[model samples]
Target: MGKIVLSTNVTLDGVVQDPDGQEGFELGGWFHQFVGSGDLEAWTAAETEEAQGAEALLLGRRSYEWFASRTPSMADRVSSTWADSMNSLPKYVVSSTLDHPRWRNTTVLNGDAAKEISELKRKVDGQILVYGSYQLVRTLIDHNLADELRLVVFPVVLGTGLRLFGETCRRKPLRLVDTRRVGDGLVSHAYEFVSVNPV
Candidate 1:
């Protein structure tokens, strides 16, 4: 089965909202503001490398829309460059409302997220990466489906915003497999689920 990986950019307080400042949120651009110049370059390089290695990309509805709007010109660029790197690696967007994908090599998933992911894992080789989809990540976590987490933790805390994890969720112990300081002050960490108590 392919490894299911959750990768995200999060703040010190766990906020994962628009790090790029395009979302119209007052704090949407916190990443560029807080991340040190040196750290930013390292983080980008690391992320670019990770994206190049993904066999498939999984995204939530909101993330899909955001990506679609932000990089329309890069849609073909993505397909030709990184998108073409894998074995016809497709993108699966989980949504109840979206009826079709607007980009090539993209599919809309309307069924149970867990079941769909299980089927995909059975069919694919290498790793499937989930990026910047908090809601989907939460569901994957709840179902004990996520195999690994790659988090780039920034130094600044957005006093309020959407969080990567919620307080209501049960705690699951994670085994830290790797850690490194990238660019300026950003800390990159990789953790695997050690034990999961099914909800």
Candidate 2:
């Protein structure tokens, strides 16, 4: 069975919005803030390692479009290696409206999202990576479909933004599998969701 691994970069305050400053958020570019501060290289290496280890990519419609739009320009960037791994991996996107995906080796899951994802978990072996799909991640966690979380935490408090976990999210316990510093200021934490039977 394939494990659903939700991977993302987040601030110390748990904000996951616009890390690269691409979406024009007010406190965007928290990722780039560590570039010259001796963290970017290590962070990039860690991200690359994660990407290379993933068996497949799962994303939401907006994130799929975002990555597709940036794919052409990613070849020459510092993230080129990671981008290469992403582009080469099989991609699954959950969207009712997306009829055709421009990204190569892409599958559009237009049917019931939860059902399709559940079926996918049974069919695919190894890890199925989810990145920046906030809504999708919430749905997985709420439905008890997500298996693990790989968070690369940056040392910054934005005070407010789109957080990874929302207020109405149900209580789910997680077991810390690993925690380590990626760079001078960045920390990587891995957590697995613990199964709990209700009374």
Best by lDDT, which number?
2
Candidate with maximal TM-score? 2
Error (Å) of candidate 1 at residue 171 is 2.5
Error of 2 at 51 (Å): 1.4
Tell how far residue 4 is off in model 2, in angstroms.
0.4
lDDT of each: 0.81, 0.90
lDDT of 2 at 106: 96
Q: How do the residues 1-199 of candidate 1 rate in per-residue lDDT, one tens digit apiece?
A: 8898999989888889889898888889987788776776577568668878888888899987776664446545433343334324578899989986786678888988889988888888988999888889988887778899998998887799888886536777889999998875888999998775466
How high is each candidate's TM-score? 0.87, 0.94
Q: Which stretches of candidate 1 lie over 4 Å from their true place?
A: 72-88, 167-169, 197-199
How many collisions between residues are there in candidate 1?
Answer: 4
Query: Among all windows of ten consecutive residues in candidate 1, which has the lowest summed lDDT?
Result: 78-87
Q: Per-residue lDDT for 35 in model 2?
A: 49
Candidate 2, residues 29-144, lDDT tens digits: the string is: 88888544468878878878888998899999999999888875787876789889988999999999999899998999999999999999998998999999999999999999
